[model samples]
Target: MGNTQIGHTDFMSKVRLTDRYVASVSPPPGGRIEIFDDNPLGAGLILRVSQTGRKSWVVRYRNEDGEQRRFSLGLYPDVSLAEARKRCIQARLAASDGVDPAGAKRRRISERRSRIIKTFNDLSLVYFAASECGEWKPRGKRKRPSTISGEKWLWTKHIKPSLGALPLEDVTPLDIKNLLRGLVDKGQDTSANRVRAQIRQMFNYAILEAEVATANPVARVPMMGEETPRDRVLRDEEIRLVWRALGDPGSLTSAQGARRANQRVYVSRPVALAIKLLLLTLQRRHEVAGMLRTELDLDQAIWAIPGSRTKNGRTTFVPLSPGAVVLIREAIRLADAGRDHPSAFVFPARWDRDKALTPASLTRALRDVSKALFLPSLTPHDLRRTAASHMASERLGISPLVIGRILNHTSEKGGAAAVTLSTYALHDFMPEKRSALIRWDKLLSEIVSTRL
Candidate 1:
């Protein structure tokens, strides 16, 4: 090993490169210099020192074609002398095997960059943005806001904590199975299924659109459990119990008529009115929870729900019964009383005046009430089912078609009937929906007023 001068201003020193020697070397005053490693393990490793005091490790090698090439190992301090030697040895071996190490490094970096979504969290952000921008709509229909909101809630509460940080390619079917298993163990079987479906769709999107994931891990994973269609129609006594619990906190007592001292449940007046409206109108929980002031016409007794908010992506005009109108007005009054300025939502969140009462909050409220009343587990959606069930009873004999219209259910029939109903039928069914709701209101009034 000897010293050699390449140019007038630059020189090369042949030295045994070590941590101590590399750290002791100083930069040249005018130009850069390369210190070649004399140690056998260093191979073609050299430490480049620039006039600005920057030091980096570079490995010089010859390709299969005998062309000279220089590949950077890394910067000094960040990449130690021993590590640089190790990388220098590997690079020299790769060059000896006729592979261009620099090109290979570039390809690896390019592939990583092509995988724009690195983690599940990154995939979720891109997926949600694409869905919002109409990139992933099925049959040219955008996802409903409530559906998106629910999915976001699920992601934040359940999915994100478990899988958000996991690399997209590393999420195995077993990971998804274990995630679903955890939910199932917590008695969230339906939620587990929903989470499974969401994960499946996300991975499908990753494969189809992002091109980052080669396969869907959730494709092989089965549903957590068999989800039976819920038919728990509330009996009249149960309905009365729910009504009393919503209206009177004192009525929320155990089956033995004893109020749990530690678990006194209180329903806010606006939430109570919203729950009452849910039963009276037979609308979805999110629909009732997100009732907007602009959607309601108290004079015309109509609630025109826009397509953006409805589950079926159709604007529905719900004919409000007198009872429904009364509930809405009461909720509005309470909302106004609680806020300095009028809120756009009929049922504004207790903490945030600008935002509507979330469907999750409604669910929680019903959960508390159910626990206090010692009632079988009841969701707010169950209230809608109770009304629809009662309307279709033998006593009322309300036509299923009318009930369907009142519920704003999409026509599920096929062929000419479906074609006519979906394509040709311009009838809003307002009159029929109104009549059915009025009859339901009358029946509900009786059920609530009757002493059990």
Candidate 2:
């Protein structure tokens, strides 16, 4: 027991606080009761209990200005006796050094809140907006519509639903690892890699450009697996099968025959011709699918792909072969005959005439035709590879550089030849490219004519 000091007529009780003793004390009748912990008699802590049985731990000390201050430690049982005593000792040390622990704690809390990014979903939008406006540095160009659409697809499908509501700062590498593992577990390695790339880009923008986060949590996450490049070039026999299947549907079985028979709805006249043109011209699937009527000059046998539509952003003038010219003319004839077809696109969508046919639609038609022929499933890209492969072979006698130019491959070599081509030889290499493609087209024609 210790001598008690009355607080302006309110009764004050003093007792030694132990784990068992603190729990037994109750509040007195009228006002709140203050029971002192008598361990450090003079400058000790107080347990204040209200009439409603609410209990709180508080420390009484002198601050830097020598002013008596009573600081609330915390509620008891939630904060045990040992923890309260330890904190009180720390507060006493801070006061001796003329430091205000209460003010410091408040500033720390305020700083933490100011730096908080509430959620990933919210931060992702901010980052995407910054990217679109060219506000993020080292990224001077605004995202194209196609690029933006792709990112939105990834975000909507994978990112938003899972980690959208979680606090950005609280997203650890383990959280990212777990999310990616779930994607890989489903045998979607390519999709998992894409998700990882999207998340890494967003976090990088937040850390480096937006300055919202101190570190990028996605920096060290390994890719799910290495991707094997597709090398599916159609052989001579396969090419013959495709030609026969598209032209003669009666040669296939009942199931495959049904797919080819319902060509009006799924496989339109222009889309079927688009596949033949892809095999003849060996252009990109999108370029062939979204061909505009104005870009073609059938009189000169040229199909010009503008810089905006090309992957490399270069104006590519494809010299159409005799075989290609025949396909395009037929496509134009069919499109002109259809009253519902839009004049802007060579291959307009069947339902929506205003919009050009999507590459996916053209690809679906090609897959159906391939399936009908009972050939290995091949994409429009494989046709391009097939053409390029034949053109580059020694039998064709075409130079590798001319083949590369025909394919419009970006030059990665840092050498004199690359420098000379980029700086001096600004020509489209039309003469060499035309020669190589003509030889390739001839070979394809012989295969289709002889084998079928």
Predicted model with the maximum TM-score: 1
Measured against the true structure, the TM-scores of the candidates, in listed sequence, are: 0.70, 0.62
Model 2 CA deviation exceeding 4 Å by range = 1-119, 123-140, 164-172, 209-212, 246-266, 334-341, 350-354, 363-377, 412-416, 423-428, 450-452
The residue pairs found clashing in candidate 2 are none
**Number of the top lDDT candidate:** 1
Q: Give the per-residue Cα lDDT of candidate 1 at 192.
A: 95
lDDT tens digits by residue: candidate 2, 147-221: 655677788888888878888888888888888899889887787899899888888877665556778888778
Candidate 2, poorest ten consecutive residues by summed lDDT: 2-11
Q: Whole-model lDDT, candidate 2?
A: 0.75
